[model samples]
Target chain A: MRGYSGDKDAYLKRLRRIEGQIRGLQRMVDDDEYCIDILTQVSAATKALQSLSLGLLDEHLKHCVAEAVAEGGDAADEKVREASEAIARLVRS
Target chain B: MRGYSGDKDAYLKRLRRIEGQIRGLQRMVDDDEYCIDILTQVSAATKALQSLSLGLLDEHLKHCVAEAVAEGGDAADEKVREASEAIARLVRS
Candidate 1:
């Protein structure tokens, strides 16, 4: 099972909300809203996505990474390495 | 007119694409995809939004902020300050 399986509904809801925010951006552009206003909304949507990423990452570390660590082998090391890379991507993104 | 008025259609198209990415994320979650895979897609979506923001910010600096600065007054200072704040928010987000 995936790390986020238990929180699937919550994650889906958050993604859908972000999707709505993106659509709102389209409407603002269509109406020729001010540049600063649009940028503000963009920042909000970005924050939302970042928040979601952090939540997922937390769960992944708690469950997936923890599970591998408990198993005690090369797979545990690989999982740690993989999780670190994912965290790097999240930070850079 | 907004700084992005000329590129409204392009901006809307990019937002629509990002919306699609968000929906794809919903599907990934619903299917119980691996945590790492979902995080990877999330980063891709975040990057796309950031790129759009950078494009918009470039146009804002070139047009809106440029015009204000050209006029030479307190408005110009305010506009510059506002843009800087927006940039900071984007970076933090």
Candidate 2:
């Protein structure tokens, strides 16, 4: 998130929306909604979260990792590794 | 999440904790924490989320999927597919 604060508000807003979606999902279950209906909502919520993750990844690459690379030392190596790991996790997800 | 109300409170609490952790990580980055240190916090926060995913997965399997399978029809097939897709996403992450 380092120098990526420019988009931080957007990220937070998206996350809040996702959170509301999740709460709606829980309420669907509580109300004993139809199975397929609930699943559809789950799919939507999951996609929203994945979108958030991708956005964060982009910010990390452009700001934090970019800074590390500019610094050119142990910091660079750490940031690169972290970014790679994050990408790997998202890809696996 | 269908039929999983028994542990709903616990899930909500954990999700709240994870949300807080994510905010804390963002703060760390904003405060110009060292690269590796921020990464460490990110790792912790990610693990917390993974834990929440696992819990939800368990609930889905035991309640939603289980009920669907017991019903023995289109519902069973749909639930299984949805659950499989969810697991696939989590694994990819």
True contacts kept of each: 0.96, 0.04
Using TM-score as the measure, the top candidate is 1
Find the candidate with the highest lDDT and give its number: 1
**Model 2 segments beyond 4 Å from truth?**
B1-93
Residues A6-77, candidate 2, lDDT per residue (tens digit)?
765665566566566656755665675654455455555556656666666777788788877998989989
TM-score of chain B of each: 0.98, 0.91
Expressed between 0 and 1, the share of native interface contacts present in candidate 2 is 0.04
After TM-score superposition, the amount by which residue A85's alpha carbon in candidate 2 deviates from its true location, in angstroms, is: 1.4
Note the Cα lDDT for every prediction shown: 0.94, 0.64
How many clashes in each candidate?
0, 5
Q: Against the hidden true structure, what lDDT does model 2 obtain?
A: 0.64
Itemize residue pairs with steric clashes in candidate 1. Answer: none
Off by over 4 Å in 1: none
